[model samples]
Target: MRLLAELRRRNVFRAGLAWLALGWLLIIVANLLFPLLGLPERAVRNLALALLALWPLVLWLSWRYELTAQGLRRDAGAGAANPVSRRTARRLDQLTVALVLMALALSGLRHFVLDRAEPRGEAATGRALPVGEAAVDSERPPAVPADPRSLAVLAFANLSPDPSNAYLAEGIAEEILNVLARIDGLRVASRTSSFALRAQSHSAREIGRQLGVAHVLDGSLRRQDDRVRVSVQLIDAATDQPLWSDSFDRELTDIFALQEEIAQAVADALAEPLGVQTVRVRRATDDLEAYSLYLRGRQLFTQRGASLEPARSLLEQSVQRDPQFAEAWAALAATLYVMPSYYPDAAQTSFEQADDASARALDLLPDLAEALAVRSRIAADAGRRDEARALLERALTLEPNNANSRMWLGLTHLEAGHVDAAAEAFAESHRLDPLSGIHVGWLGATELIHGELAGAREHLERGHALGWRGPASAWLLKLALHGSDAEETARRFQDWLRDDGRIPEAVRAVHHAVAPAITDPAQRPAALATLRQAVEQQPGYDWTTLMLFAGLTDAAIEEALRPKPASGQILLMMIWSPVDADFRAHPRFAEIAQRHGLPAYWAEHGAPDGCQWHGSPDPRLECGQ
Candidate 1:
């Protein structure tokens, strides 16, 4: 009626809108200002949630307090300090405006000034980016059913009936596999790749064909009266012939040596020659209980992800059970150095403690390659470059054939700005352990660092192709390197981001920064826009790309990327390297060399006389020499 119409006056709507705006203003103040003024994250999030729900009520209340001609209405009255005149309403409105402005200013000043996040890498305690394997299209490799040696290590044939002795069976097979792995030029199937075909109806031919290997080793073991009986056979996969067969009886204590003996025999049967050194891992610990614990730790650690803490704790106990357990201590420390950034809340303290523990381990056993590697990692994270390099060199010197040491060394080279050395180290690691996700991940990442996404993609896809799908970096690089399917890439990036828990962080490195050395200002915006679009499609965008897209040239980037990694970048990007180094060589390296700008080259030369760089002054020395 008359009252309702007056409440609906044009002035009332404006006042309602103003009050709604005020509620939002209050919301901004409550959440941002309170937190900036010293509220906790939980408190800020809660406050934000509360204000979002409460703002409508705030608006309704504000609307109720507005004056209408028909009434001194609900929630509306003449101001206590005002005279009875039209100016009284104006005074009320003025008061409302003043309060709104004050709240906004305070909110802005507190929140904007205080709550800003530190740029990435600022949290030396928290970093999430990791290099990963690249991606590839699925093309089923053609079946290779030609004549070759083949054997299936059938789930140990469970002859004991007591599953507890399962490790004995597995241990026997793994020993045989390990022995076969040491042949000068053997094509033995890698354990994981071969074992993944377990329970499938793949014939010996099919298995051999799928893995691209010639021989298969089948084995089984049964324990009786603290003694185990094992039988092994080598099958020529190509011709379906059993070339060799053997059986042995041994006490439980003799099982370790027996496994190696069987492995050596299998290699001989496969016609693969063995080197002079025996294929036996030195028994670092005599304590059976500690060894068992280490084995369990290895089992759990291999699964990775949510198991990091539990595995880390179990590995720590292994070292406690036997302080001389170098492998256990080294692995535990390495896990700590890497795991915390993934589970940031709990991992930070672990990373700190790990540094001390790893250092102690290396001091206790200088011969322990694993411990040295972890110590090297700790040093690198602390920016002790020289110390880190020395530690890594020591570790590599001890275990030159170890996949882990090679991978870590390759990554270290990449960090030290030695692109050629990094690439060579990665290639060597990849050759030694091609099926390993770790090898593939670092190798692909090294390629990406060189701006060679194609090579990165190849290594990444090869890793993924091997049936390892648990890691996140592989997917992240795929999204970053491939630019055509932005929407699909964005969706894929979201899925990958949800897998944040899977990243195995070794340290928070603020390195691997993309250089800003492009001199073309005219192409800057286009390059920047493309980079931003790529970032926008990333799982988590980063500031590294800001310079990349902006095309800023660097005095250092030029020097760091000098001598380049054989133009793998141009080849992988399906583009050519602008400098002569793309397909030819560059000359900037020697001048940079005299000043100690770069380090010695570590690539595996087909044959080395050191005369490879005659025109250039020691390409292996100062200029990636």
Candidate 2:
């Protein structure tokens, strides 16, 4: 009782209360400001830990010091008897009250204003809605029916001492998924969806519900030097029950055999329940070093952008280590093919390398689905629509569960102006890889072109949430501008662009220009000027849609006719959209058709969705009928 009274008299208790309140406020401020300052998510946690560690120091200082009229001084038996101690106590009480009030206000603001201001629906929550709810929502497409034999193989936990071995763990699970995908009757979810779910806290039942799968596979890998231990379990997603579990201890040199053994065991466990009769596990490589390199390269390939060069290097080394590694060659071709999208200056060299790699992969393995898909992309870029479609069809026939093949097939269908077919293909691809932002974004874009505004908005928002910042952001802005609340949507779109670092500054500038015209018609001329400037400054990026939306059809046509149009796929797909109706009806569109090699392709095959070829004294293609 005496010590407690002494502490209160010295203002130590009041000082501690004030310190805690101030710390709370500081943590709240850090939480709000860190993201804006581009700090990582862990930075906030570190700040909280630091604040906790300083709490004892703050209390000790309060116990040992006194705030007097002469300023801070060492405590010398100061008590309630000292006027300075009483004054300091009162000040500390006031400060604590102020901090508490401020914290309450900030909390209220965050709960009522900030939270409410965020975009609504699944995107805001960053999770997919249950199928029943999503199917009933008019804004979203009907949910894909869950299959009884469907399975999702999640990324395995890496218990290895070296964190770099995480890629190997993920690679093992993905290989198992690939093996199961090749089966005749089983439906395997794409790696993107399964691996993405591993980061979330959802249970197996929730994940299965979200991904539309009936079963889930999870495992852990612990590798130390030349030895490894793997533990795996198969779960019934609907029941949240483990159906089978196993563990394997093997030498690192026998990793390939171990993978096959695990996959065969899983297949045997599921055979009776899933009606699966056989399992065929293809060996990717005989050399462990080459396989490891391939796994690392493929992991980097999935994370496009600045990682492409490194991915190319690793894949190149993998192929050099094993010339007959068809999968490595295919992965190398894919990395090179996508290099042009991120680094346009090296496009020609990259495409040539991609061609050589894809050909080698095909020569090594004639039935390689991935190589066929890469060749399909090459054909599509060269304006050989029929050839691309044929290649994609063959690839899909060989591996029906290949999401890449499905995506390429959709692009081919879109290029040929088969809107319904394109939509079906895109939807199927999205269903196969539900968490893939690319698939979702393309599906949304296709829906937008088909005039399904609600569905387009839903998918585009989901794509944006999934970290797809490329075409989806632009399409979302387009959807917003076309909405009833154009002004508010434009404002929100501008705010989003201002904060998003993933989008290029030049692209954001172009969107910034047009977004204003959504609310203020007087800004149209300025927006058009900005679009034109952007077209000249960034020839590698497609600006035709922006130009068309800005009412500059002639300039758009001219931009499309450039020697190397920005994106061949974008150029082809844009013509099918309702916004391009005028662009297509214009007399100059016939010239575009000819220059794009569409007329020859269409003549050899059949005409596109809205086009008809007229052959006589004057050879011309008529469209927009």
Candidate 3:
């Protein structure tokens, strides 16, 4: 009891609490402030560690010292005059009160002042406003072209007794959306943008305004035993009125048919404005288990990362149960194609498997838009630019709002050096899928390569805000190196590497040694040599990509054209922005171009804008074989 009283008298407990609260506040401040200030994330972590290290020292100081009216002093020895004088205790009380008030003030300022005026940088200039908020500036955005047939399908509410069946509801909405997207002349919203608005408190009218659609579709789902119940409404965006509403209760076996029924009904109801007659949709599979598994796999595939293998497994099961499930095969193919980009070690087998699955999808449903899109990507990967473009055009004709096809088509255009066409395609994809970081990042990258610094920074910043790391970070690092301070560039490069995941320690060590400052021109040759050797020793997609960015395009091309380590990496590099003009003029370019039918494509479609030499079109070099 005496010890406790002594601690209180000395204000040790108060000081400890004050220190802890202050430390927490500092951490919160640092987290919010660092990125805006262009400081490394590591800086925030180091600050946290430093604060923790000071905790024991704070406690020790508190225990040994006492505040007095005279000044701060060491506590008196046991035999000395008692230090607990009335003046001293009063001063301690005053100090504690002051500290508490300061903490409260800081909290209030951070929450109220800093929160509202937070520096998100210039890229936030054109960001979409929150629901219900009017534009803050006088310059109104150009009015969206009103398309009465345009609609967005928000995620269905999971109202089942077991909320875990949320995946089923999402799958149902997605399937319906896919069906609607296939209707000619219908401007259906991309699933990414529509689903992202699901949890917002926005009214249908506000949502329509934001999505640039005339109608909004939302619904609820409930599942019990082998039965499912769904309630859906189609609302007019301008008036917030339900234009059509319905409910369905059916056996789980009939879910596929139910989706078809819903899609057809919606199409038929909007046929007047849509200018398209309702066509009966076909169920991809009749087996209930296979259909359910397919939906689950599709959902998982969107999540990417660790979800990929499980999605592949589920998709395999889905196809095994129903070989004629064209959508499942297409989805599986798409997943396989993208897997190698994330897991380079799986590059070889993944592409081959992707090709096989795509073939199966085309075999089952020759005109399936999704299947065609995947096939188009494979064709591009094989350097068949003409074939890829034709396939993508066909896919777009069938599903104009298909963002994936549009994005891939943009890449094909980029490969042909058609800068304007590439920009248009990328812009269209971004319009359809505004929330997709990848779409926005690519658009920004196109701008960056074209020397539109201001526009590039805006989109890049927006991309970074919307889950763009990895390649986007590398691009940002490149930008920093071009214009910003050395320290900022290094910090961004570190962040870029984090996204590459589990690079070999030896490679990292050698990279650090040879390229301590990658932006430095003098060190580039040595760094490229080191990176080339490292890539040879351990064939990695990232290192090869790094080499390409490091101005070692010759080495990268040689590595890519090798028979071993076959992956889509070569195709990806070929189509990326800032095309290697020198390499394109090389004799080897003619061999590859002829093999890919590039000359024929150019003959039919005209040479790309970038295929020029000596101020005239490079007929016998870039555009001609």
Question: Against the hidden reference, what TM-scores do the models get?
Answer: 0.52, 0.71, 0.71
Model 2 poorest ten-residue lDDT run: 118-127
Clashes of 2: 0
User: Predictions ranked by lDDT, top down?
Assistant: 2, 3, 1
Q: lDDT of all predictions, in order shown?
A: 0.50, 0.74, 0.71
Q: What are the per-residue Cα lDDT tens digits for candidate 2 across 1-625?
A: 9888778877777887898899889877775665334344466678888888888888888788888889888887743346677778788889999999998888777556543342000111122321111221112322765677788888777767887888888788888888778877788888777776664535667677878888888777778897887767777877766677666778877777787887777788888766656666667778889999999999888777777889999999999999999999999999998887677667778888898999999999989999999999898887777788888999988889988789888888777777778889988998898877768888998888767899998888777667666566767666665566866666656655653433466587578657666566688788878877776787676666666656577878887776663333566765676656677766667777776567777777677766777755555556663
Q: Looking at candidate 1, what is the lDDT of residue 403?
A: 59
- Candidate 3's residue-wise lDDT over 1-625, tens digit each? 9888777766667777777777777776775665444444466778989988998888788778766656668887444575455455565566666766766776677556553342111011122322111221112222865589799997777767786687798899988998898887888888877776665445666667767889888777778898987777787877776677666778998887888888877887798887667656676777888988988898888877777899999999999999999999999999999888667678889999999999999999999888899889888877677789999999999889888789888888877667678888989998787766767777887787676878877777667666666667767765665564767766777777765443545567765654453556677778877876776687553454555445565665675555566545344333334434445665555555555566777777777675632222433554342
* Candidate 2 colliding pairs: none
